[model samples]
Target chain A: MTAALSTGPITAEEWGIVSLSLRVSAVSVLGAAPLGFGVAWLLARGRFAGLVVLDALVHLPLVLPPVVVGWLLLLGFGAQGPAGRLLADWGVTLMFRWTGAALASAVMAFPLMVRAMRLSIEAVDHKLEAAARTLGASRARVFATITLPLAMPGVLAGLVLGFARSLGEFGATITFVSNIPGETQTLPLAIYAALQTPDGEQAASRLALIAVGLSLAALVTSEALSRRMGANVHGL
Target chain B: MGFDIDVFLQRGGGQIVARFSSGAALTALSGPSGSGKTSLLDMVAGLVRPDAGRIAVDGKVLFDSAAGVDLPPHKRHCGYVFQDYRLFPHRHVEANLLYGWQLAAPRDRWISLSEVCELLGIGHLLRRMPGALSGGEKQRVAIGRALLSGARFLLMDEPLSSLDALRRAEIMVLIERIRDDLGLPILYVSHDRNEVTRLAGQIVHLGAAHGVAFATDMSQGEQGKACA
Candidate 1:
């Protein structure tokens, strides 16, 4: 396998893997953010029965093995599963598809996103919201104009963290969607595949460097956004 | 314009029972610390729910336990000037002023942004953030914010307590102008007897026992007379 691998440059095939990884991570973060924020808000402020259970459920992925999470996703969204059957009626499928990979990434990234968002939402002074209410702002308007803006830095951090987590996702994505070449072969999967060969060390190293670069960029972006937003909220 | 308030609230280890009515432009609530002055204001602003009783301003019933009417804070339209000013720290002075103004119905709105800014002398501070504002300036902005929201009445909870003597006097004159010119009923909270005597038309004292005593100061003229 090492003899057959090209150690020169990132081939077009490798580029496809990088692109697919980026797409999967972006889609996962975008799709999960609203749900994450809602869950975070509920955990932060909502008072209700079974709250502890809901919290535990939200954080289940963080503690559970990634393979178990993937297996759970497969059970719920695979072609023959209940949700999968319902989706199939709508002419949609997730099995071995990039969409399935995105779903797996989203599930794995959700806990981190929710945690960051919850902390931020909790930090927002309830007094400000009460003041808004006194000023004739409805609950929705108060959240939109005051609470959400004040929590922007946390929300940004959650998004970047989720995106990075999704990019590096290997166990869940591989277990759920498998390593299909163009459809689901993300960077981690490609790097893993390269490592399995005897002469593919150089190829794996190159892909690993790319992964490191991408994660660094995401973190830097998060820091920059959080700093700017924190300044806007406090300075202005 | 006046206030008719009788509310009962159960706090930790005690109950807060307040009953008073005033037919005056400015009704003062004078009490020592921990006498439920702020709690009563919170009830009027719908921030705190009373166990039972009624809250009416200018003949408009805001909360009536018997009638099962409990309007939310947004619908009550009681402009509150908190002791700490409670200005939205993230918003500029202008945005804070406009927050309520934008929410008010056109027919309900009686004061414009420019008018409030001019009246409170906060026009020059509009672009400044609440973080950068002095205590006096923040209080003025808070007052302007409440007024611009189309408030039918005002609730000032020790609005001058956090200010210096000079700023307190300045705001006292501004409050007088608002009372005489705008004609909006004001429920002012203060611990200083002299300050209340200078500004309040009628004074209601809250004792340490949680009892309320109504006083009509003849020196303040007929406008200071309470009906009950």
Candidate 2:
């Protein structure tokens, strides 16, 4: 415990890890939210051919091992992969970079977000949407007005869950981006590295505590925000 | 000068058929439960597509199988007040009224928001959410939202059914006032014969279970033969 205190509250290296974790998580959430919303809406309301297949496919990532996902990302986004070559030529290299780390985190956390969003969208009353239609609102307008506002609570929950998941992502981020210091080293990766060192156990424990604090803080913030919005919508 | 819908719809596992070619402006489809009344209105609202039929309103073709035309729900300029008063619970009353106004064509903007709010007596609840309002207030908001849509044809699917007796009585006078003042042609659906007598200009009666449906002018008391 004295050794933990001696390691200091926020060393430069530890701070780097904390900020990188936050940045990666934020980027991943922003990139994945709209896609999650669309996928969830489809799973909830859309009735077409292959709907069951699509639902199963979207949930596959949640059940798959994070290491496997990292391996798939490496195969698809490596320097020699088809998509990687095109991206490289366009000056947008993702392999082994911080962006690749974020992408990996997004892939791992996507299923949770989609699941939350799907449930909320399904809970929205279809009668309201039909009424909006008769009121001359188009499909997009109706969704924006009626569906989106009502489903915001689930969306907020998904965002918090995704951000927390992304912040702690280890296996996928390391496998996909190689856990480089000052670049791909997120909080979890830094903690793992510290634990592997002979005298770095103190630093690792501190980082682990910070990770726990972050997850709890994220959850609290999400709940507070959702409650405020819900109250506002409910006129309380 | 209003519209003509000449269609024959098979009802109840094809055991009965109801045919109508009426061009009346304010037609009321009224009957008891399981009378195929809602289905008849759905056919006009472009919700439930007919197998072989043609629907025209004010010389505009809505669904014409002969011409291979079927306008979807969004394209139809029809205002609807659902039986459950389907007000969007997430939105404020103002946003609910604006939703339809934004979707209307630039040239089709006939009804103003102020006019609708004034008519429905919901001007004070503009910022209020649906959950905050009473049952009667929600129905009035729903009616106002429907009317602000600039719909050429208005359809009310038992709009007053969910309200209490006192609220229903209040809304009944409001409906009558809307009919007389606004001059908006409406297609109102109800199961109550008293409501039909009170509000219907052209009444279309539907039978229970597997039976026929035919139209008559309730105001003139013309009873046409009920075809089986």
Candidate 3:
């Protein structure tokens, strides 16, 4: 609060962190989309047993400390853990790697994505899906042609929220993957590291500005896309 | 040679049992509100399960609780035109027409998209969304969608009830022409006496105390008297 925001340029390392943040967040959102859609569909349409428990579990990451989520992930997916060892044998790794950061970000961002998608999926008219059925369209076909199209706006908004969450992710990522310079470090991590040094405020302030700018851009794009897609579906 | 149905189900407080068979060119299910008319149609279309009953369309068993065979709605091959049209708002008119046709087997494909559009007089509305169309236009598109699916039978539930008087008359004429040209048997459901008198070749009446009544050889005058 005391110092004015820095208008100085970023160093090459800072640029690397920004690029890494985008990549990690992008990968997280892209990888999580299909799974997110599945969870959302289940929550929106499924009436099976333990549904409440499943929903609560999905949102656990949001309420829990990010470090706790990171630790749980590590316990289940660490190098020597059951899943982690299996993956390591296959030459795939998650612990302390960039992939782990993405995974952690994905977990942290999952609830918001699912909530947005669920709302959209629920908004779709069951009658339209029934109509598709009478036309010989199967459940899967009906979802593709009717339910998904009507829910496009929600899906986009979910993706935007997830992407922003992934970018801003720090605690889970740092705890899960550690703050390595070129590997697991992202924009948030970079900012945190910068704030530690006495004269590193300038770099931290610049990175903070980039984060704010990226988030604002994502929100604006999502808003515009949602409105346009909603209008198109509504035929307005 | 035609559709056979013996549907019995409970809804809310009362029981609904409808039994009928008709090979006629156009059969009508006419009843007042709360008469389970739409429920009967939904059972035939495989959208609702008829407890302890059987339904067959052209000798093909679509549902049979005794035999443990209940085909899903997609496999019923019964074209349904809902009262509200239920067209996909996201798709254009052409896509709506093609939706069912695309799911049809190659050998089962007989009606073309342009053919149905031309028949319905919706050729120029191909690129238009459903919301942009008039009530008559939407009804035509819905009919076209059902017909292109190569459905063995058609079940129309108050298809013209949403249209104004002028649009209703116009669409009825279109329906008559399509019925004459295709000669496919239709199960038309409506409470409107005029629509029944104009279109029905057979009548299936359901009521609270009457249960279900089936009458064939329906002439214009007979239908008018029956609905009266």
Candidate 4:
């Protein structure tokens, strides 16, 4: 293993890709968590028209090819798209930018976050919310005091999983934003680029190891956090 | 004395229609399970809106289909305890107790954490999570949580069903103490005749074809049985 690692030293350029990947994925997860939680809560607990449709729509990013998701993003948020034009007028640009890359990653990871949160929200006993209501708590207060806290384990798990998934996202990010160096070229993109160039295998191999390590670390941390939260909640 | 409710509601394939006026310092609603007991309590607490009727608490029209006045549950200052003891599992006993306290308007505040905890005998369990508690302990915490929430009235739905006979007996004594000390009107729901006898001063028997009546006698366990 040492020899294998030594065969491909992590260079400054490769390190930049690793750092950028972490930063982008982190931004994506942060952006998606609350939205994911809200969507998940609606899917899990909300009773309304088109609930199943909304649920299915949210899960679409999970099953559809990542490249298709990328394509859709391109059509909707590219520089010439309606949303992109509006954003552009405000001096905001997403196409082929890091923000677009993050957005793409968030879309790819959203289903994982929502799925985790939805299960947890459903698991929360509504009776407790009723009890809070009877105690004079408003709906918002009850959500803050009872529902959110009860579903915290799932929320935390979703966040970490989303981060990991975002970090590994390649197809959607590349398709939506394109792999521009230092801006949108994340770890996987960098590795792929490195592999295509002659005598660049060593650098690509090093980046790949770092990506694997980061993902494993994230998974382990998520598991530990969720276990602790689960224990705390179940003990109640 | 601030609230009075008189209405009828359909529940569980049977219409649990109740028409009574308790001028609110302490209104005791007692009845059997599936007897429209809990539903009556819910209506009074504003959790259940009658299909079509008028309900007023504290002389305030809480629900009136004709007047189009229907206040939501949060705005209604009624504390409710479910039969299953719906305590917040994610929160410690203290946080659970404080939940309603945080929601109350300052002027209407009634019970404090210490008083509620002491009354329910849950002072020691304040730092513990809900799962660590026994059935009896959970009920006590649930009761404390409701009491500290600053509600003007209390609604309990079979609050002792989960406990063993011994724990039930013990908690029953505590319930009496809370009722007597707080002087808060309680809409207590239970299937146990003994509970009604030991606790409620004025009872409303549901499922009886006649309507609401003042069940002033508790010694007539056999009569309460035959009436069923």
| List of chain A TM-scores, every candidate | 0.93, 0.91, 0.92, 0.92
TM-score of each: 0.92, 0.87, 0.90, 0.86
Per-residue lDDT over A45-85 for candidate 1, one digit per residue giving the tens place of the 0 to 100 score = 99999889999999999999999999988999998899999
Instruction: Judging by DockQ against the true structure, name the best candidate.
Output: 3
User: Between candidates 1 and 2, which one is better according to TM-score?
Assistant: 1
TM-score of chain A of 1: 0.93
As a TM-score, model 3 comes out at 0.90
Tens-place lDDT per residue, model 2, A1-236, is: 12456456676667778898999999998899999889998899898999999988888778888898888888888988888998988999887789999999898889888987887778777767777766666788777877787788878888888898899898888998997888999998988888888888888888888999999998887778567556644441
Most accurate candidate by lDDT: 1
> Which regions of candidate 3 are displaced past 4 Å?
A1-10, B209-228
Higher lDDT: candidate 2 or 3?
3
Candidate numbers sorted by TM-score from highest down: 1, 3, 2, 4
DockQ of candidate model 2: 0.50
Pairs with steric clashes in candidate 4: A235-B131, A236-B130, A236-B131, B2-B58, B3-B57, B3-B58, B26-B185, B27-B185
TM-score of chain B of each: 0.93, 0.87, 0.90, 0.82
**Candidate 2 residues B79-178, lDDT tens each?**
7877777777667789878878888887888878888877788899999887789989988888887777788777888978878899999999998988
RMSD of 2: 3.5
Interface RMSD for each of the candidates: 2.1, 3.2, 1.9, 1.9
TM-score of chain B of 2: 0.87
True contacts kept of each: 0.78, 0.66, 0.86, 0.84
